[model samples]
Target: MTSALRVLLLCHSFNSLTQRLYVELRALGHTLSVELDIAERVTEDAIELFQPQLVIAPFLKRRIPESVWSRLPCLVVHPGPPGDRGPSALDWAVLDERADWGVTVLQANAEFDAGPIWDHDLVAMRPASKGSLYRREVAEAAVQAVLRAVARLAEGGAIAPVAAAATAQTWRPSMPQSARCISWQRDDTARVLAKLRSADGQPGVADNLFGHACHLSDGHAASAALLVTLPPGAPGELLARRDGALLRRTVDGAVWIGQARAASACGEGKPFKLPAALAFAAEAQRLPELPASLERPDDEWGELRYRESGPPGARLGCLSFDFHNGAMSTGQCEQLLAALREVKRRDTQVLMLLGGDDFFSNGIHLNCIEAAAYRTGDSAADESWRNINAMDDVALELIMTTDRLTVAVLRGNAGAGGAFLALAADEVWAHRGVVLNAHYKNMGNLYGSEYWTYLLPRRLGSDDARALMQRRLPLGATEAKRIGLIDRCVDAETGAKAADFESGAIANGLALALSHNLAQRIAAKHQARAADEACRPLAAYRQDELSRMHRNFYGFDPSYHVARYHFVHKLPQAWTPRHLAVHRERGTAA
Candidate 1:
């Protein structure tokens, strides 16, 4: 048994959980201090006054300053699980209709909510009122988890942090009011319901038809009310009224009013009725076209919205490639290359957006590759060499030659050529649930792309990259990051957590690691040249092997085998030197 502990509680609002913890700590004969409205910065007064050996921040909106944290042991009670660190965690989970949720206690770091977790307690929810669930169930779970964490800390026992993989499949931020705006033209009833639920009980879900203003309310489970002005020549618009509900017709769909308030003559009294003449005039005023319902087109996977508060030109330029339908055609490739070259001339930083939602790409179109090979009527070795070389050129142009910083944001499944495209970027940011595969080897083709020969080795080491190619491995986002294939992993579906990618964290981290005092010395000598040359032989070897593989695999339908291999093998193998050395030598230093 351990002695009682000193605890400090930081919170914006005093809730039942905070009260419970206060009582529990006191009952245990522990010292407890409470602070309210703490900002990100820590004041010396606070440190001196509390002088806590262990600091516990529960329901605190502000980030703890390094000054305070560096001095003593501090733990944050996050409302969500390891990867679920962010504001609005509960709201998002409910809106997404997730089956499970949890709370985590982590060592606080400069980076918000990303610290290695100490312990967590999972919370299971049934279909109940969102407000009640949050206030009751979530609060209880949080307090209990915190108490356990404190006990563990006192005993000096290690608490294993849950791996990101242990969590659910999707993530998203708390729904913003903008997300709730209903577009009559683009959205269906189901989508509308989702949006409403996302912002359910929030201030903006329902709005006045005339001014388009939403009602302001507290919490997310409260009833919503709205006001509307009817159009002229709208018959019996008040034909139906039940309770406070009002029914009206629009140019398109029939509008159902769940609840409404009619403005008084002076707009100052209760049970007020809008003057008939004024209501007519307000409706007649020329209003801009009402937006269509919010329906996403079939082609759109998803979109990422970003706000930058940096200097002018600080925002990176975006270079987008749509592999949505399929791989780029020769013509498309040529056009893309030309555009990239032009962007380079302008010195613009570029971020490539591949297919939205679930795919950066599926890789080279099988039909295109097969046609080219058949037309040549060449030996397996000859056709493979040509195809690999072509792919290599495309990859190299994007990865090596571009002057501006390049990043690839992948939200979906990427395979073969798609994987290479991501690797080519200066940094790769992927959602946590993304699937990445190197399907080339199984397709009877070696991994033929360019800088991948160099980049893969730099990231995963030559041995690992070789194994991956040889075995045609497919990886989850976490595995990809672990092997250095991708720079960072995030939950793509929810966009909730601040994954390492949001602020160019990956690029910055890599730059720190790679940028060395010896870099200047190495650049001055022929060491860089030597390393490049040493790798050349390996590239040539791989190219040749890849070509032969493609020839052998062609006409057999690579997809079936690739899929079978991934499902059956569980893990991909590494490529052999015997295969890779052949192609590296063919493309010389020119």
Candidate 2:
């Protein structure tokens, strides 16, 4: 291994990719600091302050300052292969249905993405949304390429570019709404899905419903079972609603548009992405309602799902909750709790909680909570209170399930309240590529609830738990396993279905069925729960946490509200938080 070097990360946001790289680089013993891409001068200031040996722009929205990069070695992570030069590299790849995609670590120079490639990984593409593609393949590739580039930089060597890509370049412009536009009357299911999936996360495809304009996102190809039930209307007309998504007929079949934003939110008001049903509640109410049970077909799309396998004596119940972007609202929490309670009463010996592949859960739905302020009688505070309480209730149910071995299977990422909720399980099984943001204070000093006060202390002792909570750092799966934050971190797996909660549990369902002392272990689990409950009622821990959260919600200080607004509206960062911008730390040598 090469020696560690001082590195600075400049990104548009501390997104999943950035956080993953942060944890990875830190684990490798590199001295790292982060600076948000606020402006060119801010970039220059950070460079001067840190005086870093190298800089990595994992996810920048704009060009880096030439002044700094010309003087310092900077590597830009492009979510595309060598020779690809554009803002919408991944977007164009998805839209054009490329067989393979890649992540390139290139030297930052005069011409963007035309720099010498330090390393790159070209892999087969999966049929997924832009967001899913970014989180999974794009992220993993970038990590590998970036690690290699950094190691090469540490060891004395001459960097070079691949001859094929350096000889020529393909420059694609940023995809616009016009390019992503769907001609419902002409486009078939395949064409429609490609368009929607290409722009799933940002600058969603412009469309209309109920004679009102809206932007479509988080789409799923309608399964045969669902399509058979839906009665087709006009090509563009919505035929049914289920699980907060609206089912609309395409030229040939239908697709489930999970989330949307109202056109009215575009011009004067800030647009919020929400469940399609909620976005057009009045219009959606008039549509045909599609009912789906937990035991529905695996191919069907829904927010929650459940299945039972294995023998009667040692049955395994697998439950999945695939909330959009893993942001669980109050309704989603309640539904999940209901499912958990139902499965708890079953004769299963193990319950696997398989969260979505893109994101396990980031916590409560900030966009939905922000939307509450626009409703006639709803307040954001009330919605927040309801969402957190519902989350707490779900955590309580998991904590109380002692008869079965509960495992939180994290295929993607988990953060905030969701991170603690995973701790509610008997064990947390994480994918090797998974990232966990195990703190809540980053969100404008939120005193999070979700039973973290009780859960965190048990795994990590009181002092360690308190320190972890205040750290506000994202933990890699390996680091978390080393620190005992997670039970197991397994190798990465192949691609899973998108938006459909259809992936199986990871790490062989944590070998729950094969344990030699399964019964005794369960008995011990019961005893441990009983002991903890007797010492301090679970309700007390909840009350204390919620009491602090109450101050964040209904209290005089509006930090939480301000943070939520900026987050939901995708506002530009005024300044990097002191926690991440560590160059601002005192007593630093010049």
Candidate 3:
């Protein structure tokens, strides 16, 4: 193992990649501090204060200062192969249909992404959005490449020069609106999907919706029933609206646009992403509505789903909720509560809550809450109350389910209220690569709800629970298991491949495993519930948690509201928090 060094993390935002690197590096015994890529003076001050031996830039929007790079060794993680260099690397790769991609850990130089390559790890590309690919494939490859680069630096090893790009491997310019505009009169469903998928998260596909210009996101191919219901006036015509999405006809088929941001909502005519129907309420209400339930084969684009397996009395029930960005809005929480209730009515011996592929849940919908302030003349506080109450209802339902064994199979990362919501289940199963942030203090010291005060102490004792909450650090699957937060951590090898974690094959294996020995599991679950209820009623637990959460929502202290606003609006951070910027704290490691 390399000796520990004082490392500085400089990034545009404390994004997923930055968080993962922070946790992993800390685990390896390195002292770390973070500084956002704001002004050049701020960067200089951080460097001088922290006095870092090495700096790592996981994500950056602007160029690094030449002064700092010339003084100390800096490593830059570019989301492309060694021969590739550009601002729109991932975008062009997806649009151009590249089969293989990689993350390159190179040194900082005069030209961007043209530094000597310390290490690089290639990954096979899948048909996914640039955002999804970055979160999953790019993230995985980045960890490997970054670690290799760091190790090389520690050992003072020679770095390899980046090979010259062939004529075919020219620079990819920033994707323009012309390339993103969908030609409803000419493009087929596949072509349209590719364009939208390329721009899924950032600068969404610029297109016309309801005769108004808006950026389209969360695009999915329309189901057969949806395609049939359209009036067929012309291509690009809004066909129908269901759940929170609107269906638009394409040349061959149609696409279900789950969410859209109008060109007139907020900020320089760039609106934050809102549900398609909500953004165009008047127009969407006129379109035909489809059922949100997954029971219908024709249904598409709903956030929540339900399924049942196994035989007779020994059955397994699976309830999956795939909210965009894993956010549970007030309506989404209510729909999920109803689904959970219906699943309870079944005779299933075991129940599994399958969250989305990207995220299990990140707590209440901050974007939706923020939208309420502008859309409806209501305060964000009011919307927050409703959303939290709905989330509690869903958790209370699962907590009170004594008849069947409940399992929260986390296919993706769970944070804040979402992590506690998962704890409401009897058993928590997570994939190897999953990250869990159980604490809520990171959100401006907001005390969380979802019966965490009751759920956490039961799983982990009072002392460990308190420490876990105060840490405000991301927990990897193994550490979470060790701390008793998760019951089991399944390695990615149990499935067909490691990537099957994204496909939910781990959840399938979990269901099958429970089915093999379900009778005992259900009986034990019932007995444990009876014991816990006898000691203290579940109602008391809910009351206590809600009492505290009530303060977080409506208390005179407006820190939560202030924090929520800044987060939803994507405000730039003034400085790194003391928790992350260890250099600012006393008792610095030397």
* Best of the candidates, lDDT: 2
Q: Residue by residue across 228-280, what tens digits does model 2's lDDT show? A: 76654789888889889999888888999998988453335667788889888
Best by TM-score: 2
Better of 1 and 2 by lDDT: 2
lDDT of 3: 0.79
lDDT agreement with native, every candidate: 0.50, 0.85, 0.79
Each model's TM-score? 0.37, 0.96, 0.92
lDDT of 1 at 121: 76
Better of 1 and 3 by TM-score: 3
Q: Write the per-residue lDDT of candidate 3 for residues 1-590, one digit (tens) a residue.
A: 35777789999998888987887777677788888888999888888888898999999987789989888878888899886878888888887778888888878878777777777888778876777778778887888788777776556554343333223445777889788788988998878878888888788888767787788877788777666666657887887777788888889998888878784444353377888888887788898887766664524657777776665766667778888888999999998888888878887777888887678899999888877777546867889889988999999898888777788988778999999999999889887667888999877677788988789998898998999999887888877888789998877621123456534643463455457666677678788878988998877877877777778878988788888878876889887777777776653444
Runs with alpha carbons beyond 4 Å of true place in candidate 1? 1-315, 349-355, 367-391, 444-451, 490-546, 553-590
Ranked candidates (TM-score, high to low) = 2, 3, 1
TM-score of 2: 0.96
